[model samples]
Target: MGAAVSDTSTRTTPEHEASRTPSPPGGRSRLAALGRAVARRRLLVLLLTLVVVAIAAALGGDVAQRLSSGGFTDPKSESSKAERFLADRFKSGVPNLVLVARAPGSVDAPSASAAGRELTERVAKAPGVLSAGSYWTMPGAAPLRSRDGRSALVLVRLGGSEDDFRATAKRLVPKVGGRQGVLDVSVTGSAQVSVEIEKRSEEDLAKAEAITAPATLLILLVVFGSAVAAALPLAVGLLSVLGTFLVLRLLSAVTSVSVFSTNITTALGLGLAIDYSLFVVTRYREELASGRDVTEAIAQTVRTAGRTVLFSSVTVALSLAGLLVFPLYFLRSFAYAGMAVVALAAVGAVVVLPALLALLGRRIDAWNINRALRRLVPHRRERGPATEESGFWHWLATAVMRRPVLFALAVVAVLVTLGLPFIRASFGITDDRELPASAPAHVAAQALRDDFDSGESSALSVVLPETDADAGRVGSFAARMSALPGVFRVDAATGSYVNGRQVAQPGPAAVRFRAPGATWMSVVPSVEPYSDAGTRLVQRLRGAPGAPGTVLVGGQAALLVDTRDALAAGLPWTGLIIAGTTLVLLFLFTGSLLIPLKAVVFNLLSLSATFGAMVYVFQDGHLQWLVGDFTVTGLLDISMPVLMFCVAFGLSMDYEVFLLSRIREVYMETGDNTRAVALGLERTGRLVSAAALLFATVMAAFATSGLTLLKLLGVGLALAVIMDATVVRGLLVPAVMRLAGRANWWAPKPLRRLHERLGLKEA
Candidate 1:
């Protein structure tokens, strides 16, 4: 049962009217007024909150079904255009459905050949199949037959929308896969890969939630020292996650939203809810302990901690908003989910939470677990400081300040050393290897890598939009392409060429390369499709002459190049948005240019260290023992670093705001910088560390995901949070403040006037 609010001083009409008539030298505080409003109508607020949450839960029940499993390519890129060109003009693009067929003996046996041809023809007649070819059907296609002579590939191109392709694959695989006469078959390709990833992601999310929910509740119970207090944050987190799912579901109807965003929604929802709740509830308990009654304690908590929550949420949301600058919806989807969850979490903490606190009052301190712990141990000290100057954090801060230069140098050196490995970091696109080894798609891909002679399924498509079916001109261009380094063969209207020689005359396959004014050829490569050599080959092909008309190259390699260029072009703007907004917001909060600068610098350092650690473990494959096993592709996914930076930087700034707000409060009360730093650390030290530990626990649960990218995100963010809280906030902050001294709070005269007029500080 919840406690009833007995304080009637602010509930009376006369008192409320007097409170509204504000005249205190400084302007009226909106946050404090909001607190009073929630207090005055606590029952209505709770009822409305529950109604909204129930609506969200209902609307978002089928959100996972609505989400897309892929958005990694820029739809406007040239590679995407070329792909569309092939499917539109020639009714064919790259093979998106592959059947790897094996025989009891050689695939060339009569029974195996008959089964393979039947399989190919069956797939060609399927609803969404554009065209299908195989080792048995296409003459001079030696690469499709594995070197061991037992396995062969049946490549089928499916033409439709992405959703249509997924539907077709789901239908066709079950009907035509498994066994065909004397041949045994396994299915793979982009369609199958997408289906597998979607399934794995859903499984990972369910498992992560199962792990984090009870673990986080137990951690919160320990951190708050009471069951009633701990339950509030979990309630807020549930509301935030469910609310974000509704937002994402609505967004998916209008635009593409990635299924991967669901993982981020759950992780950040719980993490931030716990963070803001810790700040608010802890501050409320402190006010109550300092002798404020239910009403005033709620009001003060809202005025101070609620404002900090507001400012911190803005910083985090802005950082995530930077992802919108990227062309790929994969990254943009995260921006959508992250900003939505942050807004909902802040609202839940600042509004609904205070209302609940008003209803509960001193009952929040009921079911005290720490009291039982104290009784059991009898000698262990209680959590918070007995005095401002006597706590462990206070002692640590003072000790660091005493040797500022040494502490700063030592901390910087450690961070820089951790960041060294990132200098050699390489980037590539994710493939089937992102799935667990046991996944069917991954198993099929491994068979291709080991058995196949060349990467035929991942060939480059060079389209000449205005070219006709002229034998001389087409054959010349095909010869030049086949001569290029890493190219295995080129299939054109004229013929199939290898090493600058026409090895076979035009056949049935060559007929597919021409339609009206448009013609296309596929340049198959011998190198790994997503490797460094493949990239180099794409660059060379783009520059190679001998085109009858305009040449547009498209494939996995071209897509990689275009995506990389797009990211490079958009990165400056993303950085500008994040950095510019962060500077302006921090200045408004602290009324100090130097403090904001220091915060940004420290955040960059912390994030660089996180990136370096990721490169070391995920990129170079050093710690598979600790983070679990994964295929070491020798290059990290190109989108992952950018995604991680935005998420981790925003979270690191969350801790910065928490520490700086408390320090500014102390400094405003006492003019001594050293004492403010020490006292602030003493007050919030346990709280920040506890918040980071709990958030890290949530991220760590997701780190156990079978998807390597998800694992990288979890491990990287967990490291960033812990390092920021302990090393950067706890150690470097005090040392830097000691060295900066009085200048840390200084600004120009005009800026100071502006700050005094419109700054976001509490009175």
Candidate 2:
């Protein structure tokens, strides 16, 4: 009876198993478990974070709208206040528009007069136009009378928002009748310039998207060696950028966020998303090769690589937060925006990405379709034991160990040489020449300079007492200012009024000075605007002879001078904050003081090389065409260096974390420095190279952008990454660590305890 029952049971078991079908336990099961875990947690965190971001976005949007509607007014610095007051009081109450007219051959009296009238009438009747006049109507306005009479000018005053004013100008241009010789009609003014900037900004954003999106996609594909895997990172990166824009749009309401910030965020988000995802995917692949079940591999990848990403993001955010030390509103806005993007990228990489990978299962590598092709690729495997003379890494280890100190010194020397140019660096605001020569604003500015004293558009405000008692004092002050070397002319109408009417003529009061050839030497001793020379000039002018009861100097130059001073004052603090914070994060991760110190020193070298290259390229006038078309104005923008420092430092750290994390991993397993460095480099070298290439492509794409500032940023950042990854990290880092040997991991007893408690675990 027992034998009969057993036979029946075996037959029944075979039938049941055949019907049910066994599930594959390789990649699919692990991915599914990972998806479940992430779905459960990510939904809650994402919803919460989205809610917070939404609220912040709404508030920011309101602020931006109010600020924009209020009109664009730069905050008053000490030097700017006086100029602001003068501009408020003396300049025409309406924004000014400039018009130029040309004839086929030569502009004769008849053509000039006809063109002037035609333009004036057209401009005056245009919407938002307050008034329009030609040289014929305003005698002694010699600047408007072209020397050759081939060109004629008309000035129009506009009312309302800049957009309204620009529309009026645009409409007026096409309406002016012209002879067969006239090629085109051009209108230029502050309002028109603003419109052009906005238009150009939109164009730049589109260009950035076009370049960054595909470049990022290509980079991910190359890194993952699989289209599906690559697409996952790209998708997350796009989401990060979209979320960032939405956040920025909202923030723009309450604060002034430059349109440039959007491009920056996009580039950063894509780069970081790719970077974080690469690390995780790489680990995930390693786990699969090691024969881990799908669920186990996914869990291990998240536990290890995901944690590293979290730490890396935190470090970058902290570095960006240091921008808060700056008083500049633009820098502050950038810092907040950048931090938000970094946080989002990190979260997306760890959360949304894992879930998606789980759904894809074995398909993560499905894109690597040729099973035979996949088999041909070498898999990561542990050698019998790490030693000084056994494998591909062993040879590299031996070579580096031979001349560590010399390599270190040579690298330092090279970096120092590159950095030398920055000591003589100078900065200025974006100049008119930054625009394309064909741009109406650029043409108008050139025309104004060539026809007038070159100072008509840029004026200085001199403050004197408003009362009659200070008339003599005011006149003396005006005279002294007029006598200054750069001063072209002085307009001090003590009793003058608009409409040619006399108001209560006060005693000689504050005047406006137009300086055409203003030099940094005359303003302050420094070669840069807002430098020591500018500050000194402000101080001297404040105490000029017959000074008003309260004299103040203000204008564009003054504002720039203030900006320079603010940057100069804040630079030390910013540097210290960035360096200190970087060290703390590095120390926390590596549990070794030496590693953090080495990273900081190496990062500084990379930064110096980048700055020196910029000075040579942008400031010193070398390779101008290769970088992009830019007017070599002999100075850099004051804010650019500060922004570069914070940004470059953070990005350099990104590479450092990537390369060093691998080295640290190898070291923990082997306790062999030489073996670890060589193996680590072998493992991460391709990824780092790929990342650098992607970054370079993204930045170089911006070379075609019309915006000079964006071009500068792109070139500078791209150069830094390439140099750091290839030269500093590839050669110097390993060489120095090889020489340091056991000392590399040395930590004091108290610190060791701390590291044990807080140190990041290896992926």
Candidate 3:
């Protein structure tokens, strides 16, 4: 049998191994064949990837055109119904812009009239503006009256879809700002919102490079202790990001890709590249120190560290793929873009990196110096053997393990307490004032609100037919709607003659309304805009009577109302999908049910804490200064929480795989959970921390972008990663595993058999 094994191994590599060994082995032959295969075909794979990306890019313009032509069409959705009704009655969509004019202090009669007239003239001539008029000057418009009479608003209707409006606004903003006596000018419309999202995404990409590149370099310098070694990971990471962008640009042609997708893809790719490269390079150094030749060290690194990286990358890609369960187009694009970036980074690490290492050999470490500076900064290997565990980490693990039940209970209690704020969570798309106080949009929005009827720039309309024009019928409908509680006022255009004719006009509309920023509605109990309560109100209004016609309710409040409902309805299913997928992947990787269960539990805990912190800072108005100037509108965006959940869960699982892969390797070899946990943490902790910090810093740079939504996402994600790396991964992970002991690796006998048959072996 031994002679046969030797003969089998030598068959593929007789010339190469004949001088080094007496006999070849099967494992050696198989590995040699695999290496040769990869070496032979690498150029083809790379060229194929580039070709695919180029094809996709070529198709993107057509895809964008199709998406732009498909305007808002969800009539069944509450907001869509309102939009349709408004379109039919007014022969137009919602006003595209709200232009504000403020008096020196407060608006007097003369100032109000002058401001309104001037705004009308200036806005009407504004480029890209189809029509601009003052609501205060229009007949039968009572909602435009401001209590203090200090502000006036000009409503500008633009021609086109949201994207068109955005393109128009980008050209119009500078011109609007140039107008005389315009204390502040802001274009707040759907188009402006899209523009802002795109602008912020670009800014985030720039900031990510600024932060991630430097942070990654610093980390490499610390780990490899050589300038060349430190620079290699950054180079690989940059290449991965560039390749990812080219691919995404191509995918955008055939699919609806979110503006935010590029930023997210770049961040994920850079992080993984740094992490995977760190693992391989570190292992290669170890092999070199053990007196292995350059080619041998590269081969050993590929066989061991490269396999770990492949498994880790596969697990992460699967986790991100869970985002497909979300119905939102943006999220689906995020999943595609994120998964592609991660896969590419993995390939770069395992294939491109190995080829480079093979070609560079000992030259990779040639930058090492033995001068005074070098003495002051010892190399990673020179610092000490990794077998020695720090007293701090050891004590922490022991204390938690000593009182396993208490530690577990304490963690759960803390997480639950933090999560309480989310129970009453509300979401909405806020006015421009939600931006920092210094932002032009915020200043303009506040000025508009202060000078006009708070609702002048905002109103809730219920469209009813002009045929119901009798005093009794109009009075009854108006009284019923107004008295429905929370209804501020109801204006029915009764007894009015159009073109001097008294004939009942079926298309003539009746508008019912409420106070600006009111939290209540007749159809549902008083609830904040975009909250579950408000969404329910929208549903009730849609079902309400309008005699011969349907009543559609819409406004900023209504859009938020619908968005919240959609998110809430979808959240439970999304959570289940993510959790289920993560569990399956963990079981497949570790061949243990307990580890996956533990991972899920801890991930939830980390997520809960993250949400609580978001509420405390963004909602409850804590740490306002540290986070930058943001107005607390007492509500969060409904989509923010769902987006955060998907992102945070995936990232937490990413670190879990990194830490646990090392632990599992040790466990398989020694069957000692405690020793494995300790040693694994010690070995992987620095790299994990570095990776987390790089990501956090990249995200944190967005806080300065002057976009509230992007800033919120950045701050929220940065906090989650910091907490996960330090609190969850560093402390809680080891503690729980030590307590679970042998049971953590337990699997049923049948499952073990399955694992043996199908399990992936370490390369």
Candidate 4:
């Protein structure tokens, strides 16, 4: 123990030691004191942890059932208002359930017509169906018939929330779908698509768990060289996941939470648990190797690595907080789950993990596998931990520092080039194409696309709940809407219109379009519902003159437009929240204005490259073989990039904090900027690399999902972590720091005083 202190003292100059602020009177940092307390109560802490895990297990078993399958739309947008008006006034909204019935021959086959009417009547009279209409029931409804003249449409509006409608679809599809007498029937709609996505997501979650757990454990064994040491991280990971499930389950009771959040909870909880525990365990082992007593080693490990873990967790949680500013509950759910799981993982690492280690003492390294492995392969022995001036990472840092400008420019150019494709990114909502071709809902939706002349189910619904215009004026409005570009036809209370002319007079179907004091028009578009042209058509409809009353346009394209507008409005606040909190936290940790600013900017750069890759692969459909086959929509899902930015930016800052914490400690100890950078990279480079690898593995498992949205998220995050860990952390950070020199740690005088009072430092 004395020799260890002597070695540390010898490594630092007297001037550097004198320049450092002294600790409080007891000379024990709060984390160190907490570590001692934990050591004293190790048994009790483990027992309490077991009890909590047990409770979490009991309460979280039904979490999957409770999570909703939809939250993509902005509930406060005009589209939402339009939907509400339709539902409140007419007891119906857009059709979210469709059944296609196909005939064997043309000329309106008698058997197919009877089967289609029977199917529509059966569904319309069903318990959850709000309204139903078909080609056979609605007069002069040519749009309901396929262009090929084999299949006709049966559109039904299921009345409820997304979850309720999805549940109704699940109950109704299997009963009415498939062969109906002489006709072939298939059921699909937005609700059914969401149901299928939820099912696939659950399956993918299980598959991801199966792939990540054993693989992560194996990697942990190789990294730690001890089965006992490797198992500790897995245990903490499991605890964190269970705790997050409970948190999500509880949150789901009072507010909307997306089912997909379960996957994130598992991936992030396990990955961060492994990251934080690995750092703590590695530092503890190093302290033990220095001949310190078990208690003292535990205290020192908590004081340093534990503090870093806490800081890293906070940075991650704060970055995730940016998602809350968005109106979409889908993104907000991730924010909730992410923040909760990060906090739990941090607690598990710093509190529970330390207690477990304290109890184990030297047994933490029991059941060593490195010796046996080395004996089997003499050339493949595990290396010892590197010293300050040594190791491959140290060499790379020195090399990059030697020509900082050249290296910086080269790396930045590569990153910017990779990011160039994002300049042309096209954004749209997730649709049936998000599902794999093998999915039944995808097959049904594809049939609609291939057979139908226009998207009737995705028609823009122009609702006028209090229109006072006469029937002739209403007919004029419908005629004008039909003449607009992209509009195939318009159905109103007065009649059906095509190309500025009324083609059909009031019929049985026209009654549904009117009430005592209100009316609505269905403007069916010729363009794809999720296409840019579809969005433009919606904007044009909203701007069209000669409306009878207050007009609110709603439909799939309108929903997309409103959602994009909502995201655009919230994006600045989200940026401010993420960047501002990151600056404050990093400043508190490093007391350096430049480092925090650099971290925020670099994270954005790395994320830009990731977004570019997402566009090139998922949007442009260049790497279908890599991420598995998916429909090429020519536009990325609008909500995914925002979610990815929050998650990937958080993770990028996670690595940043890990590296900066070590660098700051070394800088404080030696006051040599260049030496500190080199030593810090030597100490933490392997740790960050290992953590990123494990996290990337977890995210890669998500890329195997059949859903393209999940695949985009998984592939994007994995790419971001790898790029951040390697290109950003390994190359760019050292080069930039070397160029900055002493200014890397600079702050204004007032801010320096503030940092001195509030900054985090360990004894």
Candidate 5:
């Protein structure tokens, strides 16, 4: 031991000696020191902020191209597998273009038929179309023409995934969809609808941002009572948004980012930057109001409010990171966008905003736009912590404390009742219904479903493992499928069979079903697509007894089944990961296990109410007139609610962190649980509501978008945030903490020891 110690002593050098010395203090201590340093070098910090914004602007322009349009299903599922086989072997892809050709009188009239056939021939020879066929050419095909005979359909299969197909489809639209001989033409299908959804979403994202910006600026002006103070958070929001785009651009080089992620990136970045900046700026002004000098106030504010922003951001980021457990890129991409936004927003609040504060000094309140408004309330100063004016929050807290059990029971009842709609939620993939009724794709799809006995888009394609000389087994499989309760008909290379009756011999319609080593069968549905009956038929087809491993199902119905199962399978584990980490993080912040657990329960209650309202309004069509052109599918898309839960949970916990941190701060200083809860409620109550209102407003603007799914996200999140601020934070939190008493800070002795050694706190 003596020799080893002597050798170690000899090996230590100047750099090693410095590295081995006691590490600098961390958390609030380190932040306090850094805040002082930044105050001393305010100009340098300002320049650094400018540099970050400039670099982000340079890189962010190309981010749109990197994001993809589709990621709603598991790529490894049976549906995807079947599509792969069909595409590769059959030289077949899902029909990506549809032409709804209409005539003045009747489709079979000489003038209309000549025009329709001419359009079909021209489309068949179009650059991207591998094949095109219409009711004009296919005699006696009832499914190809409308019941009234005034309109007929033309289906085209387009291969290759690039601008070639979209560009070609657009060109065909003007030529074929316009006047073609005596008929009028309109086009919609898989590719055209996908294009429209992308275009509309991009426009909506821009519109949401446009509305949010001026509104956020105006709200901030009122909150801070001065243009200069208000501009600080807005500045942070802009920088954070640009920075998030650059981060996404970098991520794109490694993986395909979804365009949907961009919408989230902007929305969350704007809200969170304002939130963190509001907290910090509020604290800084408080220190100044108490007569601290500029440097002291900036340092103190960073130490406390800055620290709170750090923890709040961590909790939010971790909540999103839990989404990484799912296999879908759509969920994982959100994790990417969310974490980047939170990190950038937090950094701007702590580093850049503080430096600006030090430079501005008393000028932080320059350009007082609300001077007249301020006169309405005497003794008005923009203090960070609450004053005598916060009596409302204090009085409410006292009332809740007096009857904690009753308040808790009442809140729980409302939350539970609200979540009842989710019990029967029907999960479907996004379709024409996601678009507004005015969308051409939506109109065309509606016409097709209404007029035709069977729309090809809804037909389930079943692929057999082998293309057989054994025509006997092929006929047998077709017989078995056609006899099922919901099967409209089964068409295959063997023949065309309807309800177990041979309607037609093998013909041109069955040509696409033949391929080397694999043959496919199309099972048309008698029930409404995406309904429970349709899903059951898909399940039965997949479970067809004779060929356990030989069959694969692909279609809209199959896609939903696979997607629903995939989401369901990952959900429990996702919940566990999020809940577990949230518990740990909150415990580290508050040094109390019970407090973290209470937070989770309360968050769920608030989210349940939001979900309940979603069902009542969007799913049940209760407020149809409020949001125009809503076509209620009597169900929700599978992805939207999951996406909402992930985003809303993080945001809800953001408020939770703010409320709990304030309460814990007071409790630590005073050592009186009741006084702590009251004081904490008093301080954070107005701030939480203001922040919630601003964020909810940003979300509500998105609800104005034309799409049903976009409307669902907007309304659901806005309602959730409002509920958290008013009901959960104001009433439920205080009531529960009052009931829990000192137990709110309790921990196991071992955990208490661990927290003592390594725990976080606001200054």
Candidate 6:
């Protein structure tokens, strides 16, 4: 609620055909039977999918309409209490729109003054306007004019939810935001910023879709070696996405889902659909190539890859579900949307894709889009530890295993160094500054910061919920607040007091400072907001000695203080839930306490790296030149890093699922840890990297976004994804496992039995 405006922004593979360990007997037969059933009833599966698609489309089209723009602040905070109380009682307790006007020369110019006055008048008359005041109209309001005399602000009060405000802003923007002769007009405020952010998010989502969709298709085609095969993953992705929209729509009835969650849902849904479908189709092809009949191949594919796909989804969905631990709907929305997409992706790939594969048979590769490209790209089978394609992964594993300490230390050093920036991360609230410089809202916000001084209007308010204080009592409290270190003035029902002295007599405007059930006062800080002096002053007021009733602090400052505390408070629990789930899932998969601990450590380390990168790149303004435009806020929003951690950890674990399943399968068969590590790398390295690349592509597409927040999410997640899939999962995992030796798969008898009974398995 900083500035009282808030905005926030899998895989499987199976293989058969290699004569290595021979497929396990017990579960394979059952999986084969299930696959045969699905294959034989392919028509029914298709029919069911059609029904789902239609239903989701019908209900989910309005999902975007249902989404909320801002809910990042904690409701438990004192600031939230004040905001809600004020909104309910005062009708327009907060200023939601600011019409900023600037003359090329100075506000002293007659023409400029006229234009500024005209702009404010037009804005005041605009639909939904509650009250508007400016230096032009409010004769003595010095804070509304720039000290330099070139600019001024028209503050507006429009009462509504963020959605309602957006509707108002949409109609009012064109009327006020356009250039007016020599005076430039721009709109920016709590509500305008939210509207701008929503608009930018929409543009960025469309752009990302336009960019990622084709790139994903091309990559899938190359990976699957045929158009038909590639299309299946795309189809699963579409189904997951549309279905997630429907899920979000269903969720809307219960709670607010931030609009920013949509980008993540679509990107993740597509990436995971592709990831899961890739595993399923590849295994199906392998089964077919192994000379199995269609029905048998489908069964074998389901037995191994299908099972692996389900496991991957669980890990990913659980990783996201961990986000539910945080109270903020912004984070929870992602968890809900991600869970739906992942569950649906798993179903599509495991249950639906198998039927399609069964029907396609050998024709799954019929289109052969990679025929010409095959000469350029060596096949996965041909590439080993010696060749270039997937061989580097093999070589890296072998190299790391040969010198575990050296590789492990080296990789750890690199990852830790990448994470170093986060140690210095100064988390702050997101403001209009997160918008690109080209945006009018951003420009207007900058103008406000540059022009306006700390004053009564710009200051924070404290509300007394059940105060029955007489005018004299209110005057005494005002005097005490005025004496605070940085408080220049205080406005209450009795009068306007400055420097602990009464300045002006109570006027009609004084009614704002009083109410029958409650009384409120504004505290004007002597120092500029967000500065050390100003922040310290705010702290003093919050702790100030005397007040009549239940006082709740509400303003940009309180929002920051409360939000920071909330994130801190919720983090340990969020971490527990996330780490706990990861531990349980990995333990079930690997049957080893050490591996799950190892996975949790590695994931946190990688998340630190991502957070550090966010701080360095976006917060520090390191890539301003390359990333288009945004002023460095010098701090990342609390929500960005927290949400990123949940999503990225899940993504990192996505690759972990693919790689570990292979490692576990091989380990169970050979009992040779080193061989299992190498073979797992050999089996999955190419696919994992490809999947990471494609996922990265989807993420990176949003890197082109004009919105700084979306850019941060995209770039930060891309960094985590690529590094986790390649460096962490590929090299470090092998090195660590190699160093651990037998301990990598070690578990006590009791836990091992639990795993045997409860663990999910693939062929």
The lDDT per prediction is: 0.87, 0.64, 0.62, 0.86, 0.80, 0.77
For model 1, where is the 10-residue window of minimal lDDT? 1-10
Q: What lDDT does candidate 5 reach at residue 94?
A: 50
Q: Which window of ten consecutive residues has the lowest lDDT sum in model 2?
A: 517-526
Which runs in model 3 stand beyond 4 Å of their true positions? 1-76, 84-90, 102-132, 143-150, 173-187, 193-197, 204-208, 290-292, 369-386, 389-407, 461-479, 491-540, 543-547
Name the runs in model 2 displaced over 4 angstroms. Answer: 1-36, 39-74, 83-138, 141-144, 149-185, 212-215, 369-398, 465-470, 495-540
Task: Give the alpha carbon lDDT tens digit for every residue of 1-763 in model 2.
Answer: 1121111222222212221222234433444455447745655645655675566455543332222211222364665455334344433322246666665555555765665666567666776666566565544432355676666666665664444555655565456523323323566656566556556756776777786776667666667877788787776676676677677776765666665666677678877887788888888788788998666667777766776777788877877888777777667766866888898888788777776666666778876634546588887686578533344443544455566787778888999999899999977665455566777677776776575433434544555424332345444444556555444444454322222232233322212221221100111111222345544555556666665556556544666766777777777888888889888888867777788999888888888989998899888889976976766677777777777778777877887887778777766655656666777777777777777777777777777777676778888888888888788877788888877765677677787666655655453
Off by over 4 Å in 4: 1-19, 23-28, 379-386, 468-472
Per-candidate alpha-carbon RMSD to the true structure: 6.5, 12.0, 8.5, 3.5, 8.4, 7.8
Q: What lDDT tens digits, residue by residue, belong to model 4 across residues 133-186?
A: 999888685478888888889998887677788889989998988888877888
Q: Write down the TM-score for model 6.
A: 0.90
| Model 6 C-alpha lDDT per residue in residues 1-763, reported as the tens digit of each score | 0111111100111111121223346666777788889999999998999899999999997687678777777877887788777767755455678877778998868888788777777777877776676767755433568888887777787766666777888788787776886788788887888888887888889988998877887888778788888889877887899999998998888877888888898889888987888788877777888999999889888988887888778888887887786667778888888899999999898888998887787888776766767767866674335433236676678777777798789988988998898888766666787788878888877777666665533567778778843644678888888888878777777777877788876665566666677788777676655555656666777777877666788777677778777788888887888788889988876777788999889988877778778888887889777656667777677788888888898888888888888887776665656777787887788888888899889998888898777888888888889989888887789889888866776677777667666666664
C-alpha root-mean-square deviation, candidate 1: 6.5
Task: Give the poorly placed runs of model 1, Cα more than 4 Å off.
Answer: 1-28, 378-385
lDDT score of residue 502 within candidate 4: 91
- Best by lDDT, which number? 1
Q: lDDT of candidate 5?
A: 0.80
Pairwise lDDT winner, candidates 5 and 6: 5
Clashing pairs in 1: none
Q: Give candidate 6's whole-model lDDT.
A: 0.77
lDDT of 6 at 550: 65
Tens digit per residue, CA lDDT, model 3, 260-305: 6666776677777877887888888888899987666776777667
| Tens-digit lDDT string for candidate 1 (1-763) | 0001111122223212221222343433677778888988999999999998999999997798889888888889988999899998899988888889999999999999999999999999999999999999987754699999999999988887677788889889988778789988988898888888888999998998898878888899999989999999988898899999999999998999999999999999999999999999999998899999888888889988998998999999999999999999999999999999999999999999999999999999889998888778859656875666667998888888878899999999999999999999988876788999998888988899888988887889998888887746888988998999999999988888999999988887778888998888889998977788988998888888877888888998888989898899889999999999999999888778898899889988998899999999998999799888888888898998899889988998888889888887766655556777887888888889999999899898877799998899899999999999999988999999989876777777788767766777754
**C-alpha displacement of 347 in model 1, angstroms?**
0.3
After superposition of all CA atoms, the RMSD between model 6 and the true structure is 7.8
- Per TM-score, the best of the predicted structures is 4
Measured on C-alpha atoms, candidate 2 has an lDDT of 0.64
User: Which window of 10 residues has the lowest lDDT sum in candidate 6?
Assistant: 1-10
